[model samples]
Target chain A: MTGTGGRARYLWLGGLVAICLGLLALAAWQLVVLERQMRIAATENMIWVFGQTQIEALNLALALSDEAALQQIQTRFDILVSRLTLLEDGPQRRFLENAGVSETLARWRSGLLALDPAQGADPAALRAHVTALVAALRTKASLVMSHEWQSQATRLDSLRHLHLLALMSVLGAAVAGLGLVAILIDRERRLMSGQLDHLRAEKLASDLERERETSENHRRFADLIAHQFRTPLAVIDSAMHRLTRRSGGPVPPELISEKAAVSREAVARLVKLTDTALMMSRLERDAVLPSLRAHDLNDLVSSVIDDLMATAWDRDPARIRQSVQTEPTVALCDPMLTAEILSNLLRNALLYSPPDCRVDVSVFQSRDCIVCRIEDRGRGMSPEEIECAFDRFYRGSGHETLPGSGLGLTLARDLARIQGGDVTLSQRDGGGLTAALYLPKDDVA
Target chain B: MSLRYHIVQTALMTALVFMAVPAAAEDVLLTLTGAVTDGRVEMTRADFDTMDWHEFSTSTSVTDGRPEFRGVLMRDALAHAGAEGSSVRATALNDYVVDIPVEDFHRFDVLAALYMDDVPLTPRDKGPVWIVYPRDNHGVLADIRYDMRWVWQLVALHVQ
Candidate 1:
């Protein structure tokens, strides 16, 4: 969602790569050390030098008379001595010491001392010395061989251990890298799904709002037609009544009979207005598209009352009372539409009543529907006003100054009927209005 | 003048007899000179056999394997010669010379070997008196310097 989170993910991945690279570098360093050790093993050991010394001594004994041969033999001995010097000290001596062969090496040196070429010059003496030297060299060579074997074995073992450690570290880095990747991918997937859910929720809310607007328009058009016809029909009916009551008018009986017939037709037209209103009300009820599910009416009433207390004009929670007589009243209704209906009724009660006077709400169960009643200690509506309350845009006389769109009662009744419910406004004996909303009970089967 | 000639001839014959008689009697195998407070030690092979002997088995450059050497110790020989010196210069019959610190005689069982593996040594065998160090017994004597001191056919020690 933010650069910070993305940056943290990259940082984690970078750290994993760095760890792997560090392990690889360690492996490379070990290899370099191993190469150096191998070089020491190859160039500095005395076994082969002693072998060369043996060959040179044999040659010296065989060619004792030749000056050039003697020089070559001397040179070979010098070379052997130089190689032996490597074993006398430094890392090679330390290696021999660690291998428990230093004493043996010292003894070999002692034998070499006895076999020095300067000791005798005669061929017979030289041959005897060379013979002894060969035996000593052989013994010394074997000692060196076994010592080298042990030292090399030790070195190889440590090298293997270092390699194993490097391999395990590399593997650990790999697993950690994979784990980080998996966690990041999973988080990304969850974030994408969350975004999708948010978009879907927005689309559903908009769809519901659009459908509600279309339904409201249909109901408003029908109410407009009914209201427009009611006025003309009322005027015709009043005029007939006025004419029928007039006495001493200079008119024939037949004329009076014709006026009476005109009055009856006008009254019938007024009755048709009531029929038109009923037909429109049915149309409004039928317009309801119920996506029904089981819900609790008591919880709905409590929640709507709470909402009204907060949002309704001139409403205070302290002045409102609630009681769920049915307790856990379950109903088969669309919860959203049911909540809308209860909210409308509760809002009207809290708005119309005096600020200090209490508005009371109660939820009770009927045989087929659960009913919630919102009663307020306000000026009660007349019977005619109560009958016309369901008509869209119908504001009662002397109530035109009220802060409402006059669609509250109309929407309330329309929403109620759609959810297999109904709403009615009645006068309380104590001078208040009570609006009842009925919701169909949930079917257990 | 005839009397003088007769006298000189008798002296020459006597000198010849004396020189010839000792050569037939004994051979001098080793000569020790220089810095001996007691005087020079000229020992023949028979004289060396008469001295107290020490023995050790050791590998030598002139021989195969370890051979038991029987001889007088150099330290004892030096003492017999009443030698006073810090160092001994040993010369092989081939004239290869090496300076051997007296400490070597004290520190190691060095033998002026007359017999190797119970056999009397000859010049061809790197004897009559081979300077031998018990190399097998002492690891410190195992070096080129010490090896050079093991002079074969050792003819003289000039202790100085």
Candidate 2:
């Protein structure tokens, strides 16, 4: 298509241009012809000139018969010479020469000029000489008139043929130009359609890639759910079974209380896992509607930190450090969603780093938003891991022993978005991951 | 055949020369008859010379070179006879004839040229009175339609 289609277009364009040039040349030629016709540059009516010469010769003969005045006779003779002069020069000379009458016309001119008034000839001899010239003049005039007539007819015929040729060329140029325009328009339409098809193909390819990635994520999520929930559920089942059995007779009061405590602890773990799953499902179905308002971001962060310390036996308050860019760090967001987002980051920081290392939590006010950054002194993940940190069921590779449902970061991001905010994680400068929570700036505050 | 016909035609025309002898007699080179209130008006070289003369230079179809011409306008010439009509029939010494619209007389100062380069016109050199148009001034005059109107060796004007 490239070779043949491109060549054909060039050929069509070249041919049209050539035809237009030819038409222009023809038009210029026609203008020249019309100019020649308009100028009246060639007005020698040869037939009339020839007939006048013979007529004037005879006019002298008539004057001679009337015994007219000498001056009148001389004038008539002079007039005859003037008429013959027409046959002797210019365009008329060329015509008579073509007729092989130049010699005869020259001879007549000499003979007539010889009879000039300066010679003072008598009337009789003058009459005889004019009578002689008239006889020969009569013979040549008919021949010349016929020659002029035939040439005029041929000229007219050829002029008609020229006009026909010019008309056909004009029509040819018009058709060629129109054909060129049609081809260009059609080519433009085809090129646009081809571009649209290419764009559609690209979109389809990207859509297939995204679908495969999502299916892979679902397969990993299935395995994670089985491994994470099976342990807690199995512990609760065994403890309940031991307490309800009658084959061991009445169990000791101490053993019964201890077994009951173990069962209750496992039940709490199961409840936490169930709560995380329920919250994720609610976010996925777009069921959670956040109530937006201006709240102090620092208040939410410090409250989340307090709750984490109270819940875990090993999480020490002295191991955490807090900083604030402004007095309150105010931002526009739902208070509940902001607290949930902050708690997830604080808990992850406490769980991953060594128990003795201090965790840093900072709240700052940027130009358009309030940002809370929680930095931990744990081994930081790679760029690739950080990028996928917000995916459902995602966990750091080496932190499998850490207590987490793996839905923390994903839930945090979803809840923040519902409140018109977002969360991002990055590798800290020294040796840990930094999680940043952003909320819209509180203009009223 | 054309020669014999021309001879008889010339004899008849000479016999019918309009019998216009007047005070100028042999000097009378042109005549006006028919539709002239004076019945017949003969114009000699002297008669033309006495009229108000105008000069215009132009090249003619029958000749080679540009020549200056002096003449009285046809309207002025016809006024001598008090001639009136829509057009006039012009005849040459060779019996060449063409109709000139009366509008031509007033429209373009159509001249009955009596002199070439200040020389009195004799009958031999497109003279006595040749009908000259101001060809150089008007592009319309440089065409065959006007070419035929430039009658030479002119003899009579029958106003009608």
Candidate 3:
């Protein structure tokens, strides 16, 4: 795989490991806490049972001077002592030893047994002995309880330390994982940036190839046009020279006039062809950049109609009727290009229609665009002609009487596209043709 | 009723009342003397073997002497005395009295002994009758209070 993808995988794995480790540490800490709690509970229970039993024995000793009571108390005390002895030798033995509880119990027992009812002379002595015994027992019980409490505290402290260590280790692992991820991300970013630079270099090379192809196509077109016109110009020059240098001084006037007229018509035809070629070239170059500006589309349409009125009137004065069929709208475009587009449509309308046929020019705003329609009430174009209207240098076969170059609609479509607009010709449903120009509103432009 | 007839009825009633007194009311009484030197007491081997006495042993210990004891338990003694009450008041001849909790007797062995070191004890030696326990049997009975299983003398046991 690519370096960036590899690094991403590494980062994902690290994050997953970190998460698992974190959960494991949390579980371990929880277990430790639970175990510590259980230990404390057990210790507390043992201490409580031992204390209660001791108290009962003390009360029994005080109540019964019978030797049997003492014996029974001693027996019960021995069991407690054995348990305590086992505890002393176990994990918490140091705590019990430090409390000095066993010795205290031993001393209390000795004191009680040493008391003599016969030698006491007064009840006070016996009471004192009982009091001493009780006090001693209390001391032993308190010591055992305190030792247990201290052992619990120690265990708690140890548990806290263990938890803290676990937390620190987990944190350390997380930090390490984060560091790895950061490194991986940085590496991935570097790789992606390198890839982007490579792609940009490739794009620049591709752009250079396209520009080279465009220049070659232009060169080939210019060469073909220059070669085609050179022979015609040579023929015209030769004919003119021969006419000027004739040996017979007097020539036939009819032949001279006819030849001169023919020559003049040929030259004119050549000029027109040259002009069409130049116009096509200009349109092609203008595809790269158009002279865009805010202009009233209604005024543009009106001006084109006025320019074409003479031609339309020559066909049939009544057929040249025009009307603005829509509200005034402004559009962002080249005015020359707009006029050219409208003139072509109007001229076509006049050429194809019979006398008294009307043509309409109108403009309006639709949503965020300006729409201009040129409707001709004349012989409409066929579906095939309408579909191919915007193709370069295409002339319909039915337009034999019309004197026109087929580049008009093509130039208009190119201009519209450059200005972020479009032009379309559709056969009217009833009759004639409708050419619609859609231009972006000035604000949208 | 005549005075002689009244005297006769009172004599008869008196004689009948005397007949109702228990034989134990006429038994010989023994008094205890001197301090109990041994931290614990137990039955003499002789008394333990000969008498058909109530007996029991407990693993628990008294705080007066040593950690352990093996002897006739206090509950057995109280049971033999037909103790009807919840309390046992044990008094020495010198009026040294201690109230023995009845519940304690049920829990551990507390014995009255007449011997120590396998010999009959003398009064001067804090014996003739003493309460003793086998202190070496368990470590819990090592306390000095278990040692207070008084030795020198033990007298009346009153159940209340």
Q: Which candidate is the best by DockQ?
A: 2
lDDT, residue B90, candidate 1: 91
Order of candidate numbers by lDDT, starting with the best? 2, 1, 3
lDDT digits (tens) for residues B1-160 of candidate 3? 3365346434533432332222142332232122221322233344344444332233222222222222345555544334556765666433346766665555445566543334333332223344554445544454444544443245556566
CAPRI-wise, candidate 1 is incorrect
Off by over 4 Å in 2: A1-80, A99-104, A123-149, A170-197, A235-293, A303-328, A334-337, A355-358, A382-393, A401-407, A410-422, A426-431, A443-445, B1-160
Candidate 1 structure quality by residue, lDDT tens digits, A123-151: 45545655665666566667667777776
True-vs-predicted CA distance for residue A266, candidate 1, Å: 19
lDDT of 2 by residue, A417-436 (tens): 88778999888998988999
Best by lDDT: 2
Higher-ranked by DockQ: 2 or 3: 2
lDDT per residue, candidate 1, B14-91, as tens digits? 432332212222688888999885558888867776789999898754334688989999998888778999999998
Span of 10 residues, lowest total lDDT, candidate 1 chain A: A77-86
lDDT of 2 at A68: 87
lDDT of 3 by residue, A1-445 (tens): 6889888867777776777577567757766775545432233444754564465446545544443544343333333333333243223333445666544443343343344333233344544666565666666677678777887788778778766766766677677667667776887899899999999999999999989977875675566456545655765676677677788877678657656655665465456457656767876665346688998888887777766553321344455455545465879988877776676666667666665768766688999889887777777888888888776556677763344556667777776777889988898777988888988889944
Output the lDDT of residue A275, model 3.
60
